[model samples]
Target: MSTQVLSPPVAAVRLEQVTKRYGSGPAAVTALRGIDLALPRGAFTAVMGPSGSGKSTFLHCAAGLDQPTSGSVWLGDTDISRLKPRALTVFRRDHVGFVFQAYNLLPALSVEQNITLPLLLAGRGADPGWLDFVTGAVGLADLRGRRPSELSGGQQQRVAIARALVTRPDAVFADEPTGALDSRTGRQVLELLRRTAEELGQTVVMVTHDPIAASYADRVLFLADGAFVGHLDRPSAQQVADHMTHLGEW
Candidate 1:
């Protein structure tokens, strides 16, 4: 009799013994300390930490926005940390999506233009059907002709989310995506993010300090003093808050 062995699912993003340090003298600050993480494809993960706990560093490194002083960052089968600036820029543009708190949109562009900017920059044409689906998914089909100035804050953010999904990238990195919105608006945006991962099979990594925001993710990883301290799976808001409260003890 023979038994079959199953292979583990490949990680969408992986970091192996990653470390980052600023400056080079005695005053140099270590932003990350030997981080070893593997983000599964089609899952949503949230990162949380106290101020100066290296949450930003982790995101930057993982997203290829910054390089690690020592170690490797893998985006699928590619090692992004080794790529040169120009190559890395092109690679990132083609494979990754970003959602930021500021809702960085070109005020002069129509909603459709803003959402399709990535594809245009890449010198590619948007697929009409995919564009239609994306606009419909974000509830912006009717507003596609409008500019950013004509939209509410929440509406602008919905546009940003739509733009992030326009590329059909392997992963989306969100940096405090709900910080600029009111609680209700924030919740709505969070729900949209969660739905994207659930329905479209997009991998998402978000950085947030709010437990309510973290609760929307499938898993929450806590960082402290440049290192990972703990994590919670399928966490509740209260549970996330409690874990954060004792992060120092871990």
Candidate 2:
């Protein structure tokens, strides 16, 4: 008998020569300049760039919120760049998670209801045990019945995080998730996000301008003039700030 080693799993997210452009001809504005990236599962990565660096465009393209003008994007083994609009919408609902600065929650829904909304939209019944686990993971076990209006900003954001995790999505994309919180609360949220990646084996990709927020990630990738310029591993806030200073003005 012959023994063979199995290959490792595909990247949680991969982008190959991805580019984006708005308009055409002389008036065209190119956002991404052939970005290539691969992020593994159970990793926390942060993206930082100065103003007009294509950070938002990169996130949108990677998250399937917008199509790339060229190249390919893969979510695990699926070529999401080729999916049609409706199929892409369904795929994103079932496979991808999002956390935004605004804490986009439904006012009429309870915390638990909001968290399970993705599963509802997917027409899949929430597993009670899994639901319980996700709520507990985000420290919302006791506040499951509260409405969004009844919660504090931090609590509401926690609900959003729990909601993002409920689908057990392949990757969670966070756009300035701590932007609206005070320093102390923002620290708490960042810690929770790190824990989600470390303890749950989830892949997290965050885009932010704050050095302190970016420092929470395992690695910080820098962008400039629409391309990935460099990266730092396990960087400190001061290091990130100094690098940004060198990258030029915000």
Candidate 3:
């Protein structure tokens, strides 16, 4: 009988010895150390840290929004750190999705238009079926005709979520996605994000400061002083808050 060899599954996102520095010399500041990480497919991971702990820098490098000074960032098999500016831009547009706290939507475009804008920017026509599926998934099917200005805060954020999912990208990076919403509305958004991972088998990475928000993730990775300090799996909000309190003065 021939033996069947099984290879390990490729990571949805991988960072190898990644480092980021702001300047060249004496006044330079290192934002990230030689960090390494690999996030599995369908995993919902949260990154948390105190102020100036490099959370933003980590997200920027991992999402290909910024290049690393050394090492490589891989979205699946592609080493995004090596791509030229134009190619990187194209790759980010087609393969990565982002949701920020600002809910960056065009006031003039209808909800449906905002959701499909990514495809339009990529020069690809939106597939009607897929567009409908995305809008419905985010609970915007009924509100498709309304402009961003006409929607409530929660509804607008849902539109942003729909836009991020429209591309069906390999990974979605959310930075304080619910920062602008009230606690109740924030929970709704977080639940939507959790479902995006559970039901759709999508990889999600969120950077946030709220312990309650981090509790929604499968695991929470803590960073301090430009390096990973610790992590907790399926921890309670109180547990996460206790851990954060010990990291340093807030």
**Winner on TM-score (1 vs 2):** 2
What does candidate 3's lDDT look like per residue over 78-196, in tens digits? 99999999999999998898998999999999999999999999999998998888788788989999999999899999998888888888899999999999999999999999999
> What stretches of model 2 exceed 4 Å from their correct place?
1-5
Q: What TM-score does model 2 achieve against the real structure?
A: 0.97
Which of candidates 1 and 2 is the stronger one according to lDDT? 2
Whole-model Cα lDDT per candidate? 0.94, 0.95, 0.94
**82 Cα displacement, candidate 3 (Å):** 0.5
Best by lDDT: 2
Give the Cα error of residue 194 in candidate 1, in Å.
Answer: 0.5
lDDT string for model 2 (142-166, tens) is 9999999999899999999999999
Model 1: per-residue lDDT, tens digit, 1-250? 9999998877888999999999989999999999999998888999999999999999999999999999999888899999999999999988888999999999999999999999999999999999999999888999999999999999999999889888888789999999999999999999989989899888999999999999999999999999999999999999999999998874
Q: Which candidate, 2 or 3, would have the higher lDDT against the true structure?
A: 2
**Candidate 1: worst-modelled 10 consecutive residues by lDDT:** 162-171
Q: RMSD, each candidate, Å?
A: 1.5, 1.4, 1.3
- lDDT for residue 111 in candidate 3, whole number 0-100: 95
